[model samples]
Target: MKGMDVCFSGLLTRAKHLADAGENRSDLAFSLQESAFSMLVEVAERAMAHCDKKELLLGGGVACSKILQEKCRIMCEERGAQMFVPANEFLVDNAAMIAWQGVLEKRKANKNYDEWQPNPQWRTDEVKVDWR
Candidate 1:
């Protein structure tokens, strides 16, 4: 489908091949992590540049990775940007961020908010955020 999906599929195929070849699992995992995180950092750098943003805020479970954090910090430093990462406790999937996002959504919602139904499969780009 999308270019990213294809790239990810290729990565998975490569990882599977490595495993099937009886490669050391730890080494394979490390290689995969490095490749994935490098790609992520590249994409983040592009996005920051495209948006003319000087601040990088990382969240979610992946943000908890020390390697990823370091990569982000390096990118930020190179770009003279500020990187903000929550404490480890808040880096992973936690209810506090969800609650805070809900609070923000509720505040932005109009009178039609009650009619909005939660779609478990909702995609970030699919929703039309009129609340903004």
Candidate 2:
């Protein structure tokens, strides 16, 4: 997410060029996956160091990749930390997390999503936390 934000469109363009140059699709995919996984691990390591933490928990759909899991595990091992990746089924589905957030909002009577508007300029610490 650093250094020009590394857009996915750029990766797609690169893959297109590679495909045009007669590169095999599997190799192109492998290259893109490696590039993405490396960037993710780099950011994760920086965050772990900043927080002085020794544990890394990966989630989301990409977390289901065995290559990404192996890369994260290696990074954690080299840093003497622990990397926790749940089963593939748990990695991709976030319905429970969304439901938990709903529960929290319900507890605080903050269920009116229609009243909310997007504010891209707002910073994390500046946001209101009435639901808490």
Candidate 3:
């Protein structure tokens, strides 16, 4: 996990704990959320530049955070870039999404099927995927 991811996770856990404790700290909750958003925006900016991609696509479970979504929007606006997010149903963990991505990967490989486990350590940038 990246530094931003760790920070965001910690903030989110703290926020959830506070919310569950029946402590109505809207201001604090919002602040924590904003911090998480800031971390994501920073990570996204660095990632986009590293990949030389004018537009960055954020996917998976974390993309559903409304705060993060807004942050990403603002960050992209500042840079005159764009961010793409998949539908909510597709963002979370689902067999269809996994199978779909696997099919695309298999197509790229252009080889026969072979049983394999989905790598828990899969790194997006390290994978050979031809999204274009």
Candidate 4:
């Protein structure tokens, strides 16, 4: 929930309030790490409400967490949506992957080859290396 706008902790506090008001419900989800369970659940639920539940894909570094994966599975099942998570290699980061992505985007941008100096701290918006 680091970048998430919704506060799960606040939701938990509201759930506690509901419990105090005699509406004892235990449907809760949480993660101590930067996992995508909450976002996946939210997206799945929203999609299920509109379309057929068969087109949700979750793939990233956060997708491998046990709590996240299992919770996403349960949320998808409950919402009648399908959740797809690829293997761990697809989730983890590697420099080869970075180079591959750079090559692909470079090709699409019609970038011409030139002497490119690598920066240790390159921000996408800051650097405008027009190879073409």
Candidate 5:
């Protein structure tokens, strides 16, 4: 997590420098996004290797980026793994996914729905998969 913070900080610093140098906003944005997405893919690859997992699922708003999708696809192909990315509409935060996941979990067993408060800033790793 600390490494991720540092990586993002570096991207922000680079972006600032580029902006101050009068670089095109689009170029700066793309550069930062590419760097950040590259880091994300690297970490994902490591996680897959560590867990011996052959499937990769990319979601969230960042997954909508064509560049990220392509990079992840190539990475998965190189590793002989399957990569799943939802459609653009589902790539971002959507209630449908959340509701579907909740329904699936509910079907497994009785979960403490009362304890599941909505968290706008929730991170995927932060959620405890008690059903699992």
Candidate 6:
């Protein structure tokens, strides 16, 4: 949720309200964590179904969270899919993945490369796929 603007702000506001109401901090924190993990699992499962995938791989720093790993494990089990997580040492921040995206975009560039710029809102189909 770090880069997720709306959800991150909403979660912080909720946490503040709960704290002001004298809710047990540990319980409040776990509840928030669980909610976030559950949302991630729900979305992952949807993607798995959409792609007819039988394996789920949890990557990046968030995969180091034991709670999230457990939730994803249970979800994968219920779907009769396998879930895989790399060792904690490999779950470092996503800088490598981010950089690899630059490599990919470079491969997609051509004579019109000057038109290149990151466009988060751009449609996937809008990309020329000759690089494939």
Show where candidate 3 strays beyond 4 Å.
Answer: 1-5, 8-24, 93-132
Please, what are the lDDT tens digits per residue for candidate 2 over residues 29-114? 98988888898898889889989999999999789988999999999999999999888777676778768965776678755777
User: Which regions in candidate 2 have their CA more than 4 angstroms from the true location?
Assistant: 1-6, 93-132
lDDT of 3 at 93: 57
Model 1 TM-score (2 dp): 0.65
RMSD of 5: 7.5
Order of models, best TM-score first: 1, 2, 6, 5, 3, 4
Report how far residue 55 has shifted in candidate 6, in Å: 1.0
- Lowest-lDDT window of 10 residues in candidate 4? 27-36
- Candidates' TM-scores? 0.65, 0.65, 0.53, 0.41, 0.63, 0.64
lDDT of 5 by residue, 1-132 (tens): 343322476578779998999999998988888778888988888889989999999988878888988999999999999999878887776777779889877767666788666654465667777656
TM-score of model 3 vs. true structure: 0.53
User: Candidate 4: which stretches are off by over 4 Å?
Assistant: 1-36, 93-132
Candidates in order: C-alpha RMSD to true structure: 7.2, 6.0, 7.8, 11.4, 7.5, 7.1
Worst 10 residues of 3 by lDDT: 1-10
Which one is best on lDDT? 2
For lDDT, candidate 2 versus 5, the one ahead is 2
In model 1, pairs of residues that clash are none
Cα lDDT listed for each candidate: 0.80, 0.81, 0.75, 0.62, 0.81, 0.79
Q: Write the per-residue lDDT of candidate 6 for residues 15-96, one digit (tens) a residue.
A: 9899999989999888888777777888888889989999999998989999899999999999999999999998899788
Better of 1 and 4 by TM-score: 1
Best candidate according to TM-score = 1
